[model samples]
Target: MTVQDIRSFNRFYTHLIGALDHGRHLYAPYTLTESRVLYELAHAPRTDVADLRTQLHLDAGYLTRILDKFERDGLVERGPSERDPRRRRIRLTPRGRETAELLDERARQAVGTLLAGVAPEDRPRLAEALRTVRALLSGGRVPRPEDVVLRAPAPGDLGWIVQRNAALYAAEYGWNAEYEALVARIVADYAQDHDPRRERVWIAELDGRPVGCVMCVRDTAPGAARLRLLLVEPDARGLGIGDRLVAAVVAFAREAGCREVVLWTNDVLAAARRIYRRHGFTPVAEKPHRSFGKDLVGQDWRLDLRAASE
Candidate 1:
């Protein structure tokens, strides 16, 4: 089939699926917006209005109206923030909590009912295809927050980073099987024997989606650490991700009592090389290598934490 034909079919399929889902709504009384607000409040009862606004991307007037309605209905209470009298915080009332819980359970059931017939094996494929479409449409940009957060990787996040990295690098550099296999091995090993104290994976997320990551693992040699599998989504590049990842790794290594940090990369990764150099890493070794069906030059770099601090 031609590209145009495939595109047309995709449009029709999306519209058909959306229509099917829309027709099957079991929640008779709650609007979608109200349900969403309930869901967000379910997890965080005392959320600031500003945070809710950002998360829902709602206009100020509209959000105020919804909050007012919810308050009048005894579903939620809004009051001045305890720490900051100028800001408002919203919390669910006891009755609101019960109602929200019921609604949430019903929503979960609705989703399960929709996907009941789909085979388990096909679910991953469906999700991946949808993600690809979203990435393409958004020009490869991943969700990011305006504020910076440094935290350990959450469940399933490391795997996501590995998957996104493999897919993106494969498409961008024509990397073959070997490179993919290497990333798989790294991720698997980390997952199998994760140590919060000696090794950690840090992820930077925007809008609850991971956009950058770095891993710091304890080295066999005492007082040494290895930095591995650093990556930022292509759309998230040029916003200091590389520098942030590197700095985070360095801080982690120091906190772990490592005297030095080491990393390896291909010479083709010029941008990464520049970031490392800017952060005090120096090339210690270089070699010609052939892997992934391509001949390339690789370099090993090291940054001495003690020396740099001194």
Candidate 2:
């Protein structure tokens, strides 16, 4: 077998054996589906069937069957919601809670034993890598929230941002190397002459991982600033990270005594345009530019910072 094939087979075998061992001890009289239901209820006692349907991505018929089994087995109780009689909520019974706790402990012990020999120093890194693998396998998505801190970019973060932006644009709109290189140049120049008082770069980090970035620079015009290189990772696009970053840069520009903030972007970035408009930016100009061997339309958007605050 090829080296990659052997490695894949070993990984699968290891997981399969570990799962079987866990099941042997944890599977009481309950089926796997039943146990899953009980576990969900134990964690979220007032959960509705619709929430469970979405979380587990199960069809109505299958979920109903499982709920019926759980009810008959005395593992869960379902009733009409107090606020909405049309909705039904599920809760684990006392006996079900006990069973779930036992199963949880057993599964944890089994996995802990499997990793017992791994050094403590490496466990966190290993767990993070596994989580990333799981996320990629599931759908290559990440969650974004305001509690996510946007800070100065770390080592390798700018490179990752550049690569992701190039790949995503290429896949979605046929952008190429010239576009990537332009982004790289903007980032490199900012890095080379970073000014804490007048120019700043920020990266949005959620759960200690970089998810988005933006840069504010001194403008050529007196009392003006420019926002450049604003990007959010594909998985994190919908979570308002872009809006947060834009707001931050605008606030920073105001603090730096700037009367206006300007930005340049492609028409393809409709969402970003929407954000800029919502923050009171007006489209001041548009021009056709050839880059990455593609004719692209670029828009120059300007936000009057002084007018916004007043």
TM-score of every candidate relative to the true structure: 0.55, 0.55
The candidate scoring highest on TM-score is: 2
Q: Compute the lDDT of residue 140 as modeled in candidate 2.
A: 47
lDDT of 2: 0.76
The deviation in Å at residue 240 for candidate 1 is 0.9
Give all candidates' CA lDDT scores. Answer: 0.76, 0.76
**Clash counts for the predictions, in order:** 2, 0
**How big is the positional error of residue 191 in model 1, measured in Å on the Cα after superposition?**
1.0
Q: Per-residue alpha-carbon lDDT of model 2 for 179-274, expressed as tens digits?
A: 899888877887788676678777787655777888898888888899987878776777778887887788677767889999899888888899
